[model samples]
Target chain A: MRPLFVSGLCIASALGAGLEESFAALRNGTSGLRPNDFEPFPHPTWIGRVDGLESAPVTGALARFDCRNNRLAQLALAQDGFEQAVARARERHGAARIAVLLGTTTSGILETELAYRRSAETERLLAARDYAATHGMFSLAEFVRARLGLEGPAATVSNACASSAKVFAQAARLIEAGICDAAVVGGVDSLCLTTLYGFRSLELLSAEPCRPCDERRDGLSIGEAGGFALLEKAPGAKAAAALLGYGESSDGYHMSSPHPGGAGALLAMSDALARAGVRPGEVDYVNLHGTGTPANDRAEDAAVHALFGAATPASSTKGWTGHTLGAAGIVEAAISVLCLERGFLPGTLNTGRPDPALRSRVVLESEQRPLSRVLSNSFGFGGNNCSLLFGRAG
Target chain B: MMRVFLHGVGVVGPGLENWAACREVVSGRAPWGEAALRVPVPAMLPLTERRRCNAASRLALAAAEDAIGAGDWPAVGLATVFASADGDGAVTHALCQSFAAREPEVSPTQFHNSVHNAPAGYWGIATRSARPSTSLAADQDSFAAGLFEAALQATLEPGPVLLVAFDLPLPHPLALMRPRRHGLAVALLLGREPRGGALAALALRLEPEAMASPLPPALEALGDNPTARALPLLALLARGEQGEVRLGAVGARQLVARCEQ
Candidate 1:
């Protein structure tokens, strides 16, 4: 498999809107999760939410696509000049040659929720023509495609948590298949009541800031974020960390809970390493899916320990940015690249005591280590799992 | 170039139920059937699991089972690509209604089924497949998007891949915006190597949509549903005709599947 370099990237999470801000928060052991402050939801749970989405409205011709999700995407696209980087890619690869693949679980479904409420209150449906355009599942991708003026293949992957991580694999395949030379890949999921109460209804929301790998870890702290990266064939444009390989699998066990034995997780991790032609011993760090849910943490701990043993430093960045649902993949992928560039591994931010029974080494504090290879895991509902291997570009 | 052998096909919609039954109607050999909006469940799924699956999931699973049953292919290692324009609208509407109430409360089952990949998850659970699956959306171009994704995936793996594209109507206020949706599920079993039930070879390319005659009235009516974008692709596979149809966006970049048999 050929490598795709993430030449350009930007992230807007609860940690702040820039690379330096995120790096500083990670290096300083600062957390982004806090108690329930976001309004509109009755659930009393902590969350990681970005700022300005509620007060800031997306202006310009793209105004009709305005929503919490699209606003986050627009803001992230403008940060760190990611849109400019995409503009350059448009020139290098031709506007028609660059593809846009994003991921999200609820793409402006909040707008629908709001619309339904308004209709229920007023006894009539809104006649706006762009309601479907702004609220459909593909709305975010279409908005991003138009924002970047990309004419190549564009689609949104919605496989829950594994969504964006799988986009990296798809970009490689599409490029390797001669479909496109460059792709703008990422995900955006803004905080919404649907996610808040939906997870609450499922009893998967943590009442406190998430404590990943903690002995008493309970459930996840939901979050909202938007992140994107430009992937190009290696020799054309190089970055410190490049995507070496990715492996994907489904559990065949349960819809929500992972296979207790981590069967799918092991398959995904092993597949990624095998495809990358790297031994497990060579991986310096791992970013676990570690949603803080007891079932997920234990299952992932078993999978990681089995593959890399207790050597590689591993932690869940979800403690920093609450699990962003579909956006978790890209957000964590960018963080993995940052780990290789910064030459340090991030630790679980809010965890105090790591589970003793788990054989994997769950780092509690950030460590400055010369890291080369990193593996990021994203497992979604319905047992879908993807493991991505990232490394220095030689 | 991407080439996949269409080993088997499955489809379920209004009046048309299974592959063998739907084939006759799609190829213009029989009258198109009509039934109520309720999705029918075949015996492939057990009662316990079937009861848990929503209409959208059941529709997708039924179509997938039709293909798997017809191809007689092992489902254990199959890769799945589930594409839908809109996810489970019934569940989503229920959630919205719940939220609108004085107290917002969505059922746990509804919450889990709300994820777009719920159908694919059920597919994995029912088939006991440990293989990977992707769920995606491309609006009106979902059929083409799923085909593109599936063809690319099949090119890399040795085993056959499952491509299931489905959509159900949006309820009420949401329905007014997307007024054309109907319950429809279409499945295709694609493989690079020949299998026993292999039907025809297909090569897919993205190109400008060609000016051509509109489909017959009956087939054109099927286009009201987003998943019916596969109507032309189905015609090619079912009739053993060497042809290509425009997919994806109507005027923008489109997927053209040329039957190379």
Candidate 2:
């Protein structure tokens, strides 16, 4: 597979907006999980909620697309001059030649949830909501493409946590097949009641900041984030990293639970390596999905151990940004890019003691190290798994 | 332009039981009639798993099963692309209603079924396939977007690709927001190379300012559903004729699909 350069990228998460903020937070070992303050139905769990979405609704011509999720996307797109980069790409490849593929589990369902609440409270007819622009799964892509003035093919992937990670793979395919000369690939997942109580319903919410791979790790700290990257067939002079490969697979076991043996996770990792023609030893780091759930962490640990054997330095950055669900893939991929450019390796935050039973060398602190290739994992509900490999552009 | 061989097809919609049963109507050889969409359990699903699947999942699985079965292809290794306009309408309605009623006790099963890829996940379990699968949405253009994605994948990969598009009506109250007149699911087994039993060879190209052909009045009611956007292409195939129809719009361009037999 030909490597697609990450010419432009930006991220907004609990860490903050833009690459600089997130980079500062990550380097300073800041944790973004805060006590549940979200209204309507605030469960007793910490979350990586993005600030300012409430005061900042998408306005103007695209006002109908306004929603917490779309707001996050808007906020992220505004950062790091990503829109400007896209404008340049639009000039390089006609707007219709750049596809937009995004991922999100719950697109603006919060708008629907709020509508339902308001309708019940007022005892009136449910006000008509712009379902397509607001709550539809395609809303994210539609909003982004419209906002960025891109006219190329656009679609939204919604396979749970693996959603965003899979977008990179699709972008690669579309570009490789010449359907699009370039692609804007990423994901945006905002804090919403659906995931809050939904995770609660599954009893997978952690009361504290999620401590991934910790011996006493309980469950995940839900987070909200949005990030994007411009993928081009060739790297620009200033390009810092390239997408070496991406692999996707399904765990045929259970909808919520991962394969106990991490069969699918291993396959995704192996496939990414095989596609990039990179040996396991060549990967400088592994970013585990590491949701902090006992089962999720253990399964990932097993898979990492099976493949890289305790040698590769790996950690979960969830402590700084919780589990961003559908956005996890791109957010982490952005983090990997930062790691490549800054010559640093981020360690698992919020974990004091790594689980002794886990075989992988789970790093506990951020360290400055020159890194080349990195593999990031994002597994989603319904047993969807994706692993992405990024490296310094040659 | 990108090309893929369509080896098999499956469809379920109002009054249409399966591809074989409705070819005459789709081909305009017979008048279409309205009937309830009866989503059958895919034979591949286990009893316990059947009970766990929601309507949308069952609809997609049923169509996928039909397509795989018709092609006589082993389901274990084929990559898949599942697309829908609205995913799991029932679950969304339930969750929203539960929260609105202040009874926010979301059933765990419903929570798991809420994911857009629930159908793909269930299909993987039923077929025990670990092959790559994606679930996507493009609003009213979901079918077209799906077809493009699947064809591109089939062209790039070595094996056959299964494309499934499905959608069901949103329950009342929520239905007021976005209403669908019917439920529909369509599947196509696409391959890079023409197979012995190939139904047709499709050449998909994106064209600017292209207008999608309107559905025949006989099949017009099915048009209310996004997945039914595949009807035009299916209708062309049903006639066993070489023809072209616009699948739907992606962005600024519409996907024009030309079929060669």
Candidate 3:
């Protein structure tokens, strides 16, 4: 299948909003993880939290849908001339011809949780509109679509960590199937008490900044991020990354852990390579599914080793961005595009020693090199995994 | 475009535990009964590990078990895809509670279970298969999105893929947003069969069809029990209901399901 070019991309994450900041952080090996400072938590854990969300005000019609998640979305959408790109899309393809698809895990429930606990004593229940806006997982997508004045198909993709990456596949299909001419796709997840405590309870939160593929890697650092990309069917577009191919799979082995040998991960990677019509040797870089968890790193290591042999140069950016959960795929996809565009591979910050199993294959520190095609992988619970291949547009 | 087929399906719900049980309910041999209140099997992870998993993981595991049991589990390079409207809300609520308490110590188990991919990770460890898996959450149309993702996986990857959709009632104050009594999980085995089974091609189309007024009672019944929609759709398919069956919001953007004869 021919690749669907990514015409424009923008991002808002803890590292700093906009493609320029994020790319600069990646190039400089900056760690976005920091000690929890927003809401008090029992243990001191690292998180990639967007600053100043509480004070960020929403104006115009978007005011009605204001929340931490929406605020993050607003910040991300403002990056990289994204607003101008959308306007151009509307002018070229009409507002009704473009669709909006967003991927998120929690949506606006973080605000809803706050509302439920902090409402004034006079308040009996949450305001109906606030409740409706923050309750559904589709709220974020709807907010983006409404704010952009887009009338085409607008839907939310929520497949855990794979949510946003899968949106690329869906948007491409919609355009190919004649559902729309162009689409805005990305993901957003904001820091909330639920996500913080939930991972803590699960024992997946790292006490320090995460060390992906490190032998001493303990677990992941939670992070919040919002990212968007303008996808179009046309192949030639300025400053765009092409969606070469994507592979998805499910190994119904367990509910929480991955297959010991990375079976599903292997399938997803091989499938992606097949779809992109590129051999494993043709790939320049790999964005790993390195959550920094012991089990995840081991499994993904085995999978990457099995397919690309011990020669592939790969690194997990989680150490820099923390695991963004549902937004991980899109965030990393944007980074991979940036890597291809900049002709360099971002270093895996905080990874001092590579896991012995991945010693030869894994790239621990950042390196600058010419690269044409890059692969990004995101695996989620229930053994769900997806791999996407991106290439420079001709 | 490849023609996707629903070769086999396995479901685990409150009243319907397996295909046989599902068949009984669909055939009216037994009452459709109340939703499966909780998971039926023992936690695959030890108590130490299990403590970290949330309700979504429990239901997802059970549903995957039923789906895998319907076919060869260890042989095929199956890609597992799980979908829900709220991914791990119970765990999310617990996390918030801990944060609100301002406690100095957080449970490691709780943190692990909080990742959206916890269930998938657990499934991978238990199965000892290294196949890839994905988890997805979309509001009302999660089931459709899961189905679409699974079909896309089946087309892209070799061998079969399992698609599981599961969601449990929200915890406490969060539940007030969309209240429901039970949790539901459904899994489908999608593959490329040589000849047998009915093939359904799913496509998203923009049509002028009016949004079905008030939504059909059967569909509305699904509000409280989102997983149940799979049963009716599967039952209809098992009975050889051919052609596209659209399942999603009605408007400028809807998920179009077209099952061809």
Question: TM-score: which candidate is best?
Answer: 2
lDDT tens digits by residue: candidate 2, B20-77: 8668788888887888889888888889989988999999988888787745689998
For each candidate, give the TM-score of chain B: 0.92, 0.97, 0.81
TM-score of decoy 1: 0.97
lDDT of 1 by residue, A60-131 (tens): 988888888999998888887788888888888887778889999999887667766764442244446465
Ranked by lDDT, the better of candidates 1 and 2 is 2
Top-scoring candidate (DockQ): 2
List the candidate numbers ranked by TM-score, top first. Answer: 2, 1, 3
lDDT of 3 by residue, A247-284 (tens): 87776565557778888788888988998899999998
lDDT of 1: 0.84
TM-score of chain A of each: 0.97, 0.98, 0.96
What is the per-residue lDDT of model 1 for residues B157-203, given as tens digits with 9 covering 90 to 100?
65778999998877776676777545888999898887774688888
Q: Which is superior by DockQ, 2 or 3?
A: 2
Per-residue lDDT value at A48 in model 3: 93
Residue-by-residue lDDT tens digits, candidate 3, B1-261: 334666556666666676667665664456555554647653445564465556777778777777666354452356677777676667666655544443524566555566656666667656655565656555666676677667766765566777888878777656655676767788877776633543343443444454322322323444565565465465455455554445554225444555554
